[model samples]
Target: MKNRNYIHLFANCLITKGISRSVICDLQRSKYVLIPNSFADLFSKQRYYNLKEAPRIFDQENLSIFHEYVAVLKDHNFIFSCSKKELKRFPQLQLKFEYPAKITNAIIDFDKNSNTTIKDIIQYFLIPYNCRHIQIRCFEDMDSIFFDTLITEINHCFIKSVEFIIKDSFEQDYTQIMKWVENNRKIKSLVLHSSQENKVIQKENYGFGIVVTTRQKITSESHCGIIHPDYFNITIESYTESLCYNSCLNRKISIDKSGNIKNCPSMKQSFGNIKSIKTLDSIIENPDFNKYWTISKDKIETCMYCEFRYICIDCRAYLETPENIYSKPQKCGYDPFTNKWKWDYESFTK
Candidate 1:
């Protein structure tokens, strides 16, 4: 194997910090493997050695061990005998230093008496360059005309998908709303929260992912939270190196009922007031506005060694240690050291 001369790592593969080990991810293949610390140390040198040279350099008594390891890496197509220039032909993984906006989604909160128009909200709070998902929460009753205006305005903006959550007592002309949802492709989902009964209708296959459900009243405590493992996994995130592991904070913005812009609705730090800001572009451009966007799971406390680190939705607003930004999530009881997850749904509500 040494006669093959030079060997190099695949350009698409990424190395991430792991717990007493290293994680090797092939971003192009969407595959990952955990390697020993020894292998990581050698790889970190950036000098890929041939199979025969590995035993000589590491002084391993068992040459078979090194051979087996190389064979496994070769089988995964993570190593190549080709020259460094040949690997350069493949697209190099790059991380962005200055992203357009850390906010990929924007949450718009509306109370019973909110008079803010859809046009004004999109123009002032929505940064078209980075925002794609929009969640509109209405604690008050909203009629079809309101949705019509919202759908029309969102259709004209750069927002690709929208989810509307309204209270059950709010009467809406479903026929008109459905028609508008079908007409405007951006209206992707609708959720109704009821204070009385518990019922759910599955219209996920419709033009709009519609779910009319009954739940408790909307309060600061009532929140629907979940983490999608598929999109949040390391295999997928390895390709998006610049963004944070928390998808919610990866280019995300939220507007409160008072039209204050924040990292999230629960966060107290207001970047700026939407009504007073001329454009959201300037607000997002501020370094302080995106302070949390770079805090990946590996940088977090207990999350660093967790298998679910990438799949977990993080809450920067609440922490196990209030003063520490790297503290574990207050709601999570996961012990990565013991490989046990004790998170309870009841605890999540608080």
Candidate 2:
């Protein structure tokens, strides 16, 4: 309190939540600081710090301890010594709100044998303003002619990424698949599913794209990838108060095998067919369509106590209790109360 002139929060840092759950994040440094509850009062006052106010916040008995705490913050660059003028000029940190969208990504079930043209698929499903990415599921192997046509049509749409989930027989046309990847730079992920049992698991990078070959059939769960500890976590949806629940459910949509458009293929309800004039822009405005987007992990049973709640992606498609939309994810075996996975417990019993 006595040594430092003034303190200013770093430009990249943000203090979110109240004193109880205050989180300091440095966006530039990608660092997160969880302030302890004991220093809650000290941090509350430090938001507006000066020599005169320091004594009032931290009385004579605690002034020395407060000074030491500020010194540590300065050492870690959480707060820096600055002039009063500089402190005033520092940008204020505010919370960010995630808004609902008309479309973000889509899953289109493409039948290779169907008479549907690549141009027809894009025109019917992709609304340029909303759609960004799409995953195409092909039940039959896509021949060179069909692959070429599809790639050309998709490129015209200027979509960010295209994931191909193809079901091939025992023998695969690797040369043709590689050619397709080389031709279309937007092909981010190519997964080949085989009907027969596959022994070895392998993955390879074809330039910027990835090719994964598996023996198992592709499911809705496979569409979602592994979760990691990153700033853009799927679980952070719990914090949003907006009706648009999860990013995946917010203005996100899918076209099932029958060309029935829904929020997701796993969901039973369908807005309408792609051929109809009922565009995504119009359907998203329906209150019923936006219902699931707000179902965050905090509201989920057993998920509130789990540490991974803020990091894991929510699953509305498959719930522990099918009838209950707010039920815990069926695939998640973790028991937050017991702090043990059901799989681990079963193995222990054996």
Best by TM-score: 1
Q: Report the backbone clash tally of model 2.
A: 2
- lDDT, candidate 2, equals 0.61
- In candidate 1, what are the lDDT values of residues 1-350, reduced to their tens digit? 22455566787666654455556777677677767667766667563654556657765565666677677888999888865455445565555434454456788888756657768776655655556678999776767677777777888887778988877653434565455556676666766775455554546555565656567666542353433333444444433533355544757888888878888887778987766776777776788777777788778897777655554567677777978978876767657565444656455555
Per-model lDDT? 0.66, 0.61
What does candidate 1 score on TM?
0.67
- Which clashing pairs does model 2 show? 245-293, 245-294
Cα shift from native, residue 281, model 2 (Å): 3.7
lDDT of 2 by residue, 83-103 (tens): 676666776644355534356
Off by over 4 Å in 1: 1-9, 26-42, 47-49, 52-91, 97-104, 127-132, 138-144, 165-182, 188-251, 271-290, 293-299, 304-313, 344-350
Best by lDDT: 1
